[model samples]
Target: MTDVNSRPPSGTSMRPRNGAAKDAAPALQAVAEAERDRLIACAELLFFAYRDFTSDADKVLEQYGFGRAHHRVLHFVNRNPGLRVADLLHILQITKQSLARVLKQLIDEGFITQRSGREDRRQRLLFVTPKGTRLADKLASLQIRRIEHAIHAAGPGADDAAKRFLFAMIAPKDRDRVHALIRLPEALDTTEHLEQPQERT
Candidate 1:
């Protein structure tokens, strides 16, 4: 009997995790069933991984009285300055009213700037101010450090592999979008992870 948990050995083709993707290779019904089981296990692990990851950022966000929405807005804006509000809505997939509440707070606080679009008078282009960038960078460093610590603890190849898994989970079109927000995996070399110094300015 094949182990439900172990992925089929390299020589064997993998079954569909959802039977939705074009590339799913469930050669037999039994293999397909096993693949579904494995998918559930992966989902369970992901739930915990995401929970832990967000918790790390949550602490930082709380210190500034900003919530996760603020963090997401700032993070994306910093990554791609002058992004449109519509693009942000598409990226976040949140309702306009919800996003408006969070964005209005950030704009009111001077963390982000929304300018009238030159191309489209009806559209608003967003940018993170220097202050916003600093805060976003600091918040981002928390996750970066967490990932860096895990990667360093696991060593180099593991980091690349983890990033590949994350990108693979995203839709192909969104893969390019995800790549824009993050480095091309080579960014792991910028600076070795160590105890980060506190900002003093």
Candidate 2:
């Protein structure tokens, strides 16, 4: 026979008794700290990796009296000819003043050209000149060799894993837009019908 007083109260929670909860607190905290440390290490590794990755191109850009901004402008304009000024601003996330300075330098140096949109005359389209294309290709080749070597060292599936990691690093709000941009067919292939070398108006 069960005595009603011996039973747990109807609303009482079945929980760790005696000092069990207190004993587990330290263990849980330790696990959280360890995970935080691991993430911090990964963040530091990214900083070091980016420094080395851009070093080679930085030297070449220095020779041309340019910098990372110039390299980025050249790269995107080369890849997506006819990219709009507003779109480039969004991609770079820089102030109009900053971009104006960079764009003026590239245009003056004969590396990049600007054109007006056929449909929207006010739209300023950007493209890399033949000189710009060569420079962009050269910079890309240096980075590609480094990436290829790293991927080979990382073994099979590294490329896919690396891409997934990079995509995940993008902001949650920007992920869908970035995914669309990367997945699009090469702009050159699709825009081949347009005259690529039109003089900037």
Best by lDDT: 2
lDDT of 2 by residue, 1-201 (tens): 888668687988668775988899999999989998998999999999899999989999999999998898888888889999998898889999999999999999999999999999999999999999999999999999999999999999897778766765666666656666667334322222323333533
lDDT (tens digit, per residue) of candidate 1 on 1-201: 867898766876765455555344545666868987998999999999778878988998888888999999999999988989999998898999999999999999999999998878898999999999999999888888887888889875996678666656665546555565566655632223323345644
lDDT accuracy of residue 71 in candidate 1: 93
> TM-score for model 2?
0.82
Every model's Cα RMSD, please?
14.6, 10.6
For the record, the alpha-carbon RMSD of candidate 1 to the native fold, in angstroms, is: 14.6
> Please, what is the whole-model Cα lDDT of each candidate in the order they appear?
0.81, 0.85
Worst lDDT run of 10 residues, candidate 2, spans 187-196
